[model samples]
Target: MGAVATLVAGLGIATATSANAAAGCRVTYANGGQWPGGFTANVTVTNLGDRIDGWRLGWTFASGQAVSQAWNATVTASGTQVTAANVGHNAVLATNGSASFGFNGTWTGSNPAPAAFTLNGVACTGSVGQPSQSPSAPGPGPSASSSPSTPPTTPPPAGDAMAAVAAMQPGWNLGNSLDATGADETSWGNPRITEALLDGIKAQGFKSIRIPVTWGQHQAGAPDYTIDAAYLARVKEVVGWALDDGFYVMVNIHHDSWQWINTMPADRTNVLARYNATWTQLAAAFRDSPAKLVLESVNEPQFTGSSGDAQNATLLNELNTSFRTIVRNSGGGNVTRLLVLPTLHTSADQARLDELTATFTAMNDPNLIATVHYYGYWPFSVNIAGGYRFDATAQKDLTDMFDRISTTFVARGIPVIIGEYGLLGFDRHTGTIEQGEKLKFFELFGAQARANNITTMLWDNGQHFGRTSLQWSDPELIAQIRSSWTTRSGTAASDLVFSARSAAITSKTMTLNLNGTTFTGLRQGSTELVRGTDYTISGDQLTLSAALLTRLSGSRAYGVNATLHVHFSTGVPWRLNLITHDTPVLSAATGTTSAFTIPTTFRGDQLATMEATYADGSNAGPQNWTPFKEFDYTFAPDYTGNVITLKPEFFADVTDGSRVTLKFHFWSGAVVTYYVTKSGTTVTGTLA
Candidate 1:
């Protein structure tokens, strides 16, 4: 019964949906509004009928209709007739509802509401335009942009960090580092950080500030901690500035929950009581505060039992319960304080939050939004050594993670609030300009979140914060950083993924695939795949950039020991690792291990853990890894066209220094030599 619309553009707006249902099947459409000539959309179809075979959804537009682009889902049209499809993601819609998919497209003719469509020969009766018209007329829908080759084109598809960094120029958090001034103070140095940060926050287009503080400084020996009027006034002063600056402010018990985050017993009564007490007094402190203030409960609680490494469903329940309990105990409109709850494992991996995602359902709080921290992948995101490349794999991983979060929770009516997501403070990626990378990270993070109507915040601590710190401390390309947030995609054409080894070339050139179809990527000596024109292949060089196409592309650069994910095979199955390297080259040494005499060496770095190269975690994205030693690595010779592509950011000074020697351990009986060469952003090696 919902109205199906082609869609429009706006912020915090609800989406439109279009679809028709038949006697036995129900179909749903997303981003299906056939838009104007210079526009596009990403569409999704879901089946609502019983299990059968494959699917086919057909519709008839008025007339002179044209298609610009689409992805995640497929499309095929004949004359005035039309049909859309996906890569068999969720083909058979279960019982209750069924739906066909949609995508981004640019049309030339009229886009009046098209006639009803049929799903697998049956009519669809559900909604279309699942969400509002995307702000970026050519934005990537929920499905497309799965593997971005560049930054987004419009402003909306950018990540939350990008958006926030762009909108909020003078943002503030009541709680920062411990100050040397003692008496409950922490400092990351420089008075300018606050002003510059606030400026940056406001510039990011956000008008909000969250002040999180632990009252223990005033409380001392247990129970209702005596409120320190001086500290209290300081908090208010900062909050006042933010309000004056026109920014929304959020403040709560941050580290106060530190003791509570780790190892919460089965009976969490004490934690809940403490939560109530803290909010009771804290709320009273700012009860007169305006609607811009929000209250959040506890930080990341690992709940140390053998079962819940990052806090289990039980602990999350306690967190949610604490949310309501804080409101009930806090006197006035604490009920409308826009409370926040996090997913399991601290960060927003909705797959982990089995229940909390839908917690709003049980509670009738309309202003509530689920809060989370998406830090990409931990080991990779957090630099164990200092310099590491945030390569394409890592970038893709974060993108997919956000997509999962949206599908799992956001679309279900609950809004997502990303409180922390940025480069780690500790030893992190080195080649990247701390500030530039910081800006880019937020740029994509915010844009993508905005794409699905999700709101987000960036964690600005000592390591990543800088009015002038991050860039100066590191040798960075500062001018490259953009000061605003808008929709962004990866560098698709300039990504530079081509075989350059002598064996691969054979004096013969190759063609590249954009989404799937064939397209001319290189002409004569040109290599980059730019947006404005058509491309064709000619000579062997692939006509690309010496600076742009010389190697692999990613978020930012890093110094020596930059972290990277090394994927390879280990015989029986496959293996992978999160490693640190100061170079971009890969080397291999063929060996034998059919029957290990006494496999004493741990080939991968003992400091790292392993996982599949692919998110699937199956043999699909399998990789190899081990502790680092002189002869520590063993290669899987099976997967051919097998070359390890590393990001230049991971290397120390490959552009000027001598050609470094890269070592690898390969398994094959005797000696096997391979040829290596560099592409614009990629490095290729072939069995010679």
Candidate 2:
């Protein structure tokens, strides 16, 4: 039998009709920012059913529009029909609960909204709205009507800056294009800015926007580095759009590689002069604008490829101090305008945080926000292929990172902004990331960010969400992101009954012996798999209802592991008896003069016997297995489901780049023959 097993339940299997009856839901599609050729769109799904364990939404474009990238959902298209399946966190929804995702797409001549939508194969009740017009092309400059001299200003109230920072949650970034090469916003793929687009974002429930602008290209040469009036006006126009809609906006100098602010010692005078000149102009421009408009000193200031030194940290601190002094002296609302400062390369690493803490703590500004960018584990968050698993290790790493930030900064009255944090695309496909895994990543990331008083802003580089269509490329992804913000409040790991743990599934109807555990919240991955929709609990026995079993079986393949988490109202620690089913299959084996190779898909380190079986049915001596030498020998073997190299003298007859045939005997009474070949540093084996 495999890790998964089919068993006849003592109780009768539940019928699907009851599950299908509770499938009522509705969807709404809205346009976000867009360009002449491309656009962004967002879709929101509302559950009108009895609690749902999982959901899938479908729609078709009226025009010949092609989706380029997506987030928060697993999006796939066949002809004109588009399907968005719920990721892990947003899969479960109680009645009236909602989830959203966004995407970026391209349209040739016309972009029309899909007229209808269906949720979980059932037709949705609401009507889809028409696609709004894309923002017009950039003009020579903003018109007098669009650019007001005395804009309606309601400055953010003066108080503890950390309080203001705490109020800002779930931020969005206008990525790639606006901060693209030169001042031509459309130079990248994004469309012109529009009020309708800002309205769409506000409607989608984002409270903050980070506008990354490349100011160096738009400024004059030499001593003063005077910013062009037209470029400033254009930026001011966009900032006005956000401010008019009552959004907390942060604008910064992004991608000024030509200025070399990172190599500060040599270019200190020139960089500081330019920096001072730029902020002086911006501060004067929005001097009377609402306090909601924040000015970030610099974006990722660091020496190229170097993990910051003390000198670089000190230079950055000097630049930040200069920025504060310049802004305060510029007059008007500049005195109280919120300012964001970045550490070396905007890293959240311990060394950089320590330096930033030492520097920023000395500066006496209540309106200052320390900023950092978190890509975290590069293999999972930024990798383009495979390796995007949000498993136990990932959870721990992320939790620890956030906890460090909380202890080092937030606890000490320094508010932090995760200016940019998001998983990149896996290959070119938008839906390549497993929906459940991505959702779980967001759920934990959001929860940690919220708990730590750190605000998180998503980084969208035109690929994730379209600015032209003003609709999310992946509606489900946006929903998961939103759910993280909405559902994270008042929840902490200490409050949970089973904060982080995994249980195995061995039978069709398995019972979890909770050992007198009580929980107020229970979730499978990020989603709150409901009691009636997913399972039923009686006394200490938590039963996997047949409906859930059927759903799980259909959604996942055999041998894959699933996780469950619980929270308690009483804060009592809960005990659970875990059951594991590890039916080991023959993995791999190879040999060389200096080393032997054995690959496995198992977890943990366990010693076993290895023997050779001859063609004459004779067997060699059973050898006591040892840990692979190429791995970290200090710890127990880490079975990464990949090849492991061993240094053993027994296989010394085989040399590098050679082929050998051997029959391997396992301790489990299994015997198999394999043909192994080596090429340079690589070894491969196939069962014979």
Candidate 3:
């Protein structure tokens, strides 16, 4: 909160005020182009603010002259010279791009650099003097060397590109006890299952998403434990439907500390007034959520009042001083919340307690964070709840105990995140890594937690199998939970394309980047110009992300094909309700492209299930069109290793000239390549 000064005409320009980028941000400034005293000044950073992870550009120099030395990043000075670090490399630089760092100081009288200058507090724009001498430049242009230029610049560490995209997300168990009994959509944490574990995790690309939630079997301690208003308004309507279906949810207190840690009362004002009335009723119920509503406070906490090693480091300095007095208590839930804290037995690794380990200092608040968990060597990790058989020396002793839980929290400076490691893939799903080595160990630990920025989740409950409370939508397990979810918006080392002219459906583009940056999508339905909201191509399949066009604007409060949901891929049933809507409004409801066809005397598979009737209602109910349950039986001219690939959902490249009758959802023994090409009654095929 430090910007509000502007004088301009004489060139006073200096601003940096971010109470969260006012709304959106990519903010920059720090003298890589010059900011302080010698004053050549030119710094700007904006885009999706209000959620910063790294920025600290302070001001003031009546002359204390400190910061004389700095490096690729970290630099500090006493009373009045600030530069706070981390913004390079891990640049999500708010939506698109632009980064800056400053240097070159020394002022004698009138101008030394402050009328207002901020970077993480948001406030920038000052110009009171400097730059009118350019009009007199007629003769010899080589005379402009002003004696001040340090161009090399590199100052990073302000939440290091959203702490490397919140370290590469994946933390499950939301609205807990397996999403209060998963019916589907993984009961909101998302998990309808079957896009083959989400195209084997979007074909091996995973990014982030960690569900976890129990909130004491649905809060509502009625009146005071104060958690149950229809179970905290259905946990803020499923954390605003998983941050509007783009993932990154977190919401913990898992067992609700049995009522937020043993029912208050251990001094400190009745546990800081019941943890500030449970985070002021859960941070005013998700203060305009967007960076994926993450509020985890009390998932593991059970070590009991200090003992031994400096009272186990004074019980983690009284749980980091009750997590910075419940996140700098301004009212509750947390005023600019971003707290995660977990150590002691919840062990996110404070080096297994030897003493002095404690952290929480607020005031310098950038929305504090700290959480760490991993089952690592739990019987070849992915034993999926005592389902047994890790064999191979227990998968190399849980991969060297997950490389010692990733070399013990990637050597502090915190940001390791692994909320729940598949907790046990039940022998990677029914043993022998389900014939695929625990699903290629969740696709090589989601590219080793997006290359060690680490953020994981996969405790799965879609029915840990027939009895732990039933939830396993099947279909190769929600296509491996939508293939490790990291839907490319930025950094996963880049690779989420689609713009080959963006293909049809109305020129549906796609680019959702992160290293080179781009990401800004925003389209949902209706049809006007019908352009695909920033992205969603169909062919090679892409989403580019507008968080699914803000969940397709709630799909259908009315029409647009009346969508309750219809995302064919993000992997498995992340969502899908679109009954129909390209155009057609007859009291709405009924679509997957309803055209109507049936004459081939139907060949098996229960005559292709046929039932759909529409509003008149049929296909039994819960939406129709069934068939898919593992019907991909190879050989349709079979031989991917030799130019024979046909996957139009299964089959369709026909030139049938009326003499090409075929049907098979399961026929195998490879070799079903067909290649006819007539015209008369519509016929085309090419599988040789």
Best by lDDT: 2
Candidate with more favorable, higher lDDT: 2 or 3: 2
Candidate 3 lDDT score at position 592: 17
* lDDT at position 337, candidate 3: 50
On TM-score, the candidate that comes out on top is 2
Q: lDDT tens digits, residues 187-254, model 2?
A: 77678777777766765666688999888778898888888888889888999998876578999988
TM, every model:
0.48, 0.56, 0.24
Candidate 3 per-residue lDDT, tens place, 272-343, comes to: 455556766666666556544566666665534434445554545564565556545644334555556666
The parts of candidate 3 lying over 4 Å away from their true place are 1-171, 174-231, 236-249, 252-281, 285-412, 418-434, 446-455, 459-673, 676-688
By lDDT rank, best first, the candidates go 2, 1, 3
- Candidate 1 worst ten-residue window by lDDT: 566-575
User: Residue 337 CA error for candidate 3 (Å)?
Assistant: 6.3
Per-residue lDDT value at 286 in model 3 = 63
Global lDDT of each candidate: 0.40, 0.59, 0.37
lDDT of 1 by residue, 332-388 (tens): 656455666766645655456556755667765655666667776543454322122
